[model samples]
Target chain A: MNAQQLCDRYAAGETEFVAAPLGGFNLAGADLIGINLTRADLHSASLMFAYLSRAKLAKANLSGAKLSGANLNQALLTGANLHNADLHGASLQGADLRSANITLATLLDANLIEADLRGTNLSGANLTGACLRGANLREEKRTYSSSLTGAILCNVDLQGANLKGADLPRANMSGANLREVNFRNADLSEANLSGADLSGAFLSEANLSGVNFAGALLTGAKMERVLMTEADLTKADLAGALLIDARMAKTQLAAANLTGVRLNRADLSRANLKNANLTEAEMIETYCARTDMTGVNLTNANLVRAELSTAILTWVEWRGATMPDGSEYRD
Target chain B: MSVQTSLGAIAQTFAQHNNALRLRKLIFCACTQRWESDRTRLEQQPWPQLLQDLYYRYPNPEALGDAIFGVVKQLNRQGEYSRLAQIILDQLTPLYGENATETTQFLTEQTQFFNEETQFFAPTAPHLDPDDPDTTTIITIAANLNAMEQNLRMRKLLWCLRHNSWENDPQALLRIDLATLIGDLQQEYPTREDFKQALGQVVGNLSRRREYEAIAASILEIINPLYHAMFSPDPNLGDALPPVVMVMEQTPAATTIQSLETEVHLQTAISPPDLSEFPALDFLKSDNPTTTEYDLKTSTNFTPAQPPPALQSPAVKLPDYDRYGVRLAVMKYANPLRAKILAFSILNHNFTTDSHEWSSLRTQPFDDLLRLLHEEYSTWDHLVEKLTATAAQLEAPAESTQAAEAIAKAMKPYYIPSR
Candidate 1:
């Protein structure tokens, strides 16, 4: 049926429509609530502003369709192919999109709150400014996709994804793979990144106050000038990482890997770095007063003009290391 | 004798000059050493208290800042002292002036002194208190050591938890979080050895707690169902019996007693009963029995089946019954096959299940029943395709026939006269 006929029928309480020769049909602004057009061939159709709430379009071919401003609340689109579809400003709240193909789809400004998107293919999708708050994107295989805070991608993939400036505060990204991702200037306060893979990630100037990075991998990562007051980086791997000028007051980096790392000019007052690997690390002019660096590795490391006055350094390896008073470790 | 008195006076003057320089050097050395050793104790004291003590001791900010800088310089040779130095500088800056430039310069020059005295400072040098025991000094030392031990224990606890360090010894970390062993170590340890022992205990405790938490989390999955069942109120007490028990109690018998008795009596009463008295024997007498049997066999053998129905037969008709009655019948039957097919067609064709074609059957309340049937059909059709396919595959032919018969019967009651 043509778009006008379909709209007329829909307005008359006839919600269902089996479009004939369905390619490129423009149904913009049509009200087709609770329609079941499953497995229909609607390729490249323009469904912009369509009311498709609670519709069942599972396994349907809607590739390259424009569904902007559509209402698809609680719709079931499992295994449906939505490749390259324009879904901007759409409401997909509570939709079941498991195993659906949404590759390269544009979902900008969409509301997908609490939707089940598990196992859905979202590779290369532009979900910028989309609201996916509490949406389950866990184990959903996505690649090179961009999901921002305006996107509410809390508890989403972010694992190994480049999420520079993504506002993920209180996001349940615990156990997510965030290795090598850029988080510069991101607000990650109270984000659950426990056991997440953030090895070598750049968090420079990021606000990580109260963020939980316990058991997270931060090896070789740069946290320079980052606000990490009260952050939990316990057992996090920070080997060879840079914390220069970073504020870690009351931050817990206990048993963390700081081997050959740089903490120069960083404020670590009252911070816990006990038994941490500081082997050959540069702590020049760093503020570690009252920090517990007991049993830390300081072998051949420089502490030039540093203030560790109250730092716990019992049994700390100071072999060949220089003290702040022009005294060698042995002396 | 006069010459001896003059020589004694010259010797005394030289001794006094020599003693003055020696005393100054001794004082300088003693001050530097005290500064180096006092830092550890000073850190443990409250910042305000420590600052007050430093100010009282030096009276002059410049001199106090210089002493602090001197200690900083000594540790700076190792390159690891820069952090601590900056802290000291920041803390002292509010109290002391930017006149720290001189002290900074002196530190740079003295950096080589640390390298030269490498062997003099023993690694095992007992961190001892001054001979003149002061309560403040003792308290500060104890606090510093305690903080250090606690910090170490915390580190070890985190390490064990993260690495799954107790995988082989699950109880190791569990005890730590439970017993707050780290906090305890901070209170109990005095020496490095004591600290080490406390740390070990803490680690073991932590491992134990970790194990407990993991096990508890896993056990939650198993307990959830039992917990729900125990707490939930039963709505249907009559249907509470298990399905298998119901089936066992209602099993049907293989044969009826009446049929068995009839067969036995017939077999015993007559050895091939008299044919003349039988009602069917009269008709047989008029015909040739041998030919009749032969003709009947020939007719059965000669009648070949008509060609099988077409794959897409339009004649596979929907009954012209009252839509509501047929729908109600379908619902009552709860036949999934018919419901699925009907729902599929309605959704695919964009037609209501209550349409003329479906409601023409003369069934009761055709309209409402059709709506209900349509809903039920739609609901079932919404399942995943794989599940639908499996359901279709498992359906028996007899069940399909039974469903078709029910629909036909429901439609029969609503037939309208063709105009």
Candidate 2:
């Protein structure tokens, strides 16, 4: 049926559009519940506010479609092309979006609770305030993205993404890719980011309290003034990174790479930096109270005006490094 | 002190312990409630500490069992003899040989009693029979029991090693013998060939040993049931899993080729003829090649204008007041009954907002709400006891149940199922 015919049917209380040939249709705000539009070409269609709950739209072409405020709960849209689609305020709870091409899609304020987005291309998408609680975003490329507060991005991709100002508090982003991402002002408290990649990321002033960055990468990253209280950056790479004025109270950066990094005025209170590298790094005016820098490398680095009270520097390499009191390195 | 006073003191101590438990519960409840109202506060809270603390406190076999028994006794009052009897028997298993035999016996007895007396607390419902072997719960319980048994056996093995009992067994010495054999084989072959031969011999020897077979069987039994669960047929499961990333590096030759094309196009357009009129280009028209080269070099040294500082830190903190206000407003309109149910559920499950467990609980099927509620009630009871004890220091009267109820009421609005 043509777009107008479908619209006529929908207006007659016919919510089901099974095997309907409404390709390239603009049926915005049409309630099409339980529609079977499998393999239909809805390319560039405007289905905003359309109720397509439990609809079978598998392999459908919805590229560049406007599906904002659409209710697609439990819908099957596997392998569908939703690239650059506007899905703001859409309800996709328990939807099957596996292998869908959702590149550059706008999913702001969308409800994706328990949606399966595995192998989906969410690159350059906007997911601000989206509910993706329990959504599987594994192996998806989500670069250049934004996911603000109320967005459940637990176990989501973020590797190589620019997530500046993203709110991911209480989200389980464990085992995600966050390499080279910018997370300034992001709230990632209670988020599970264990085994995530954060190499070369900028995380200034971000609230990362209770985040698990264990075995994560932070090499060459900028983390100035970050609140990382009780976060785990264990075995992370911070080589050549800037950590100026970073608050890392009770954080574990043990065995992390800090080679050539700047830590000027950074707070390392109760932090574990065991076996960390600090070669050619600056630690001027830094607080190292109760910090574990055991077996750290401080070669050719400056520690001018730095506090080391209750800091463990045992078995550390201090070759050619300068102390706060202008003393030459002895070890 | 009289027996009644002694009992009261014990109850008070239990209450104190409960208060501590409740504080932890409150933190988790607050997290969920806050998330529902305003997720921004999630950023301010310390989550990792909360998770670690929860992991350390709960699910510790020793602590959990003891705590459960203590709370159960404190909440229920009957003759002292029955309670003391229960305590003595419970403590005996660990004190005796640390064997599962006594513990298993006690657990079995309790399970039977609870199963039979369940109707006393609530109306009788159609029960699934374990002997029928057709029910899903029965199968699940059986699987759990099997896994638990295997875990207990492993624990025993570890315990034996710690106590140096392994040295007493000739068969246990096989591990050392195997190591020595591998070392000897390495010297003789000194290569993969030798390694393979040594491995073959070890495999042959292990195949002959009943212990090795038993160990292998136990491992398989424990893992087999989980195989289907891990690889469910649902397409959603496949979608939830992450994909692998591969980084491809471009070679210098390829990179140079790409840049060379762009540079050549630009160079041809800006030839010496086009610049001959300008004073700066006069050097390019000179017969001396060195002057032309110098002029070209000087022209290339044109610096671009310095851009504004894009990387500079923001001078002012972004106000999250609006988000907080929105959340508070939401809480105001929240349903109290739902909040109480949600709070109770959270408490029962030991849901700490800062914990991975709470997140996991949120993902559970809606059908399991009753189970979740039971867990929440158990947790709430503990929390109330703890709050009462802590409030004792304050001069003003404190009612822990009332506080808990209020919290529940505030949190109800955010407790709706995603479905």
Candidate lDDT scores, in order, read 0.49, 0.48
Docking class of 1: incorrect
List candidate 1 segments past 4 Å from native.
Answer: A1-156, A159-162, B1-419
Q: How well is candidate 1 docked (DockQ)?
A: 0.03
Candidate 1 per-residue C-alpha lDDT over B296-337 given as tens digits, one digit per residue, 9 for 90 to 100:
011111121121122123334433323323443443343422
**Among all candidates shown, the one with the greatest lDDT:** 1
Off by over 4 Å in 2: A1-155, A159-162, B1-419
DockQ by candidate, in order: 0.03, 0.01
Chain B only, TM-score of each candidate:
0.14, 0.16
Displacement of the residue A125 alpha carbon in candidate 2, Å: 15
lDDT of 2 by residue, B294-325 (tens): 00011111111121122123233432222212
| Model 2 Cα shift for residue A203 (angstroms) | 1.2
